[model samples]
Target: MEPQLLHTVTGQVATVVIRHPAKRNAMTAAMWGSLPPLLETLAADPGVRVLVLTGEGGTFCAGADISTLRGSPLEAQRLAVAAEEALAAFPGPTLAAVRGHCVGGGAQLAAACDLRFAEEGARFGVTPAKLGIVYPSSATRRLVSLVGPATAKYLLFSGELIGTERALRTGLVDEVLPAGELNGRVAEFTGILASRSSLTQAAAKEFANGRTDRDAHWEERARESGDTSEGVAAFLERRTPRFS
Candidate 1:
């Protein structure tokens, strides 16, 4: 069967699942091409507050399906890079829920997300070196931003997979939980994110990603939005703020 990128939504969270368990969810070129449009639709939906990227079976993405590379390498690279950029540019919070193998392009996609949570047995690596391919500069920069240059080099240079403990220690993963607890913990955290003020989250995300400069317009827009007033009122009244 061909590889697939599956989309499913529950409440405010949308999940993009990489599906191809026969190949450990390795993505095909077509799957890579599908991501940007899917994310754009979700981003435009007001009801969707967060996105979670994960794999279909016990494993997360193993990387790009090498078989596809034998066809058109240039096109495949373009699609893959486009997908990674789209994920990184998503307006709302994005989390990578990882398990088993997350190597090469899988690691790049996870690095693009705002946060990553992994099962205790998850393994991560950046493996272009193994194939004699240069890692994309944008991906390398994101990796460096996440784990710092030395750790990033270690993964890229060696193409050696690391366990969850090492990933967490290097700041590659935000949290690591036992396999049984991963989903529940991710749900708990994303629920909190969904309930928070979107205005605040958007501003913070832009700043943290270094995509914008500090300006008076940001504060002006926030005040005009009245999100702060509602938040304060909700706090005083002991009620959840109805943010739209």
Candidate 2:
């Protein structure tokens, strides 16, 4: 199949699958360029509450297609940074459903997500060192925030792949599962996320992403959205909340 970003919405979850099986799902420059616009479309949909990014088959992503960099490596890096920032700024929760090799630009994309879940045999690396390309500063800061300065340095400096156990221990991934159970768990968790209050989730995401000035904004939203009242009523009445 031609390399592309395939997206579909089922209920409140939108899944974006990276397809480039011949190169272990390595992202082409065009694929990187397509992500921001595609994510913009998904973010605009009122029905979409969560997004799951994963690879087409066994590999999540190996990295960028090296051949694409031959013409202009800087331009390729620009596209990649744009795509990573777009994914990071997605309004609702975003999860990276990772398996197999998540390296280089693939690791960059996964790091941009709000959460990550890896299968048992998955491997992860940030490989700019291997390519003699300097990692973008924004991406580096984000990685530091997630896994701390030391661990981030280890990955960035060494360009060595780490196993699932090390990844989880260092806070790079939120969860790990056996080979076949990842899809089931991802579906079940995203369903729960979709069922919760969008207002609350939006507010929390803003705060967690380092936007400290949004307290008043979120307060106004809670007062106007009716979600708080619905939550209280649901608790008192012994039923699930129907958050709007």
Query: What's each prediction's TM-score?
Result: 0.97, 0.99
Over 4 Å off, model 1: none
lDDT (Cα, tens digit) per residue for candidate 2, span 1-244:
8999999999999999999999999999999999999999999999999999999989999999999999999999999999999999999999999999999999999999999999999999999998899999989999999999999999999999999999999999999999899999999999999999989888888888898987888888899989999999999999999987
Candidate 2 structure, TM-score to reference: 0.99
Task: Please give the CA lDDT of all the candidate structures.
Answer: 0.92, 0.96
**lDDT digits (tens) for residues 1-244 of candidate 1:** 6688889889999989999978999989989999999999999998899999999878889999999988887778788899999999999999999999999889989999999999999999999888887888899999999999999989989999999999999999999999699899989999999999998998999899896767577798888899999999999999989875
Measured by TM-score, the strongest candidate is 2
Under the 3 Å rule for N, CA and C atoms, how many clashes does model 2 have?
A: 0
Stretches of candidate 2 above 4 Å error? none
- RMSD (Cα, Å) for all candidates, in order, is 1.1, 0.6
Kindly report which residue pairs in candidate 2 clash with one another: none
